[model samples]
Target: MAFSQIKVLPTTPLEKLGRVGTNDVYIQKEGSQYTFFYKNIENKEDESIRNFSFKNVENDFENFYKIIIDGFNANPIYDIKLELPNDYVWLHYTKTTSKLGVQFMTTNKVTQSTGISQIMSVEDVKKLFEKI
Candidate 1:
């Protein structure tokens, strides 16, 4: 018998954490590295997953998240990327003489798509983070 190579799609086994809107959050471990994963389901037939790496899951991640949450104190800028790994998210703030709104830009490298959330109030952003 001769040996033949088989092509397989790369997959990282994940543990489900929770879901955020159309995105499902998960955690994966690769040796000593811990990765955060998100799967965005556009429909029953289409979905994509993205990965973000974190050094210290316990302290570093918590501190970083706190810093992000605290940033709501100031007015939002036009484009500010969050400290999250792999450029996963961007904060978009719009302020006009007549209106002020907050929005987020999230990217999925695997799918090569960037999604913009609907304009929301500052409080809505805070509540969304708390769910994660």
Candidate 2:
């Protein structure tokens, strides 16, 4: 799949970003790019879950992202479980810190309960995504 370089932006207002909030998973698609509003349902005041955008993504990537967002909306952090395809990886914000983290399960074992790596900046998240 042709994944574009992901861009992380500050938590802009949904209207300013040309997005409308749904039951959950606020998203705006501009051409082949998408801007997703990932919120923390547990804490509305949480600013850790920042808005992010990705360009030139495939349908599969978009679908998986949506699934993750929906899962977050429905359940608390501990309850969220992502079933990823083999060799597929994705980024998520840490629940407590709102720092970027990576999630993937190896054949032998799952790395973390949330499948999250150490918290990192958005730029670091982008670099790791690119490397994958």
Instruction: Give Cα-based local distance difference scores for all models.
Output: 0.54, 0.39
Across 28-125, the per-residue lDDT of candidate 1 in tens digits comes to 45543555555544333455564556666567755644654555556534455765555467656676675555555577556656555445455544
Pairs of colliding residues, candidate 1: none
As for candidate 2, its clashing pairs are none
Each candidate structure's count of clashing pairs: 0, 0
- lDDT per residue, candidate 2, 17-100, as tens digits? 322233123445566555444433333454333334455446754465455445444434433343333222344435545433
Q: Model 2 misses residue 105 by how many Å?
A: 16
- Candidate 1, TM-score vs. the true structure? 0.43
User: Can you give the TM-score per candidate against the true fold?
Assistant: 0.43, 0.28
How far residue 82's Cα lies from its native spot in candidate 2, in Å, is 9.9
Instruction: Give all candidate RMSDs, comma-separated.
Output: 7.1, 15.2
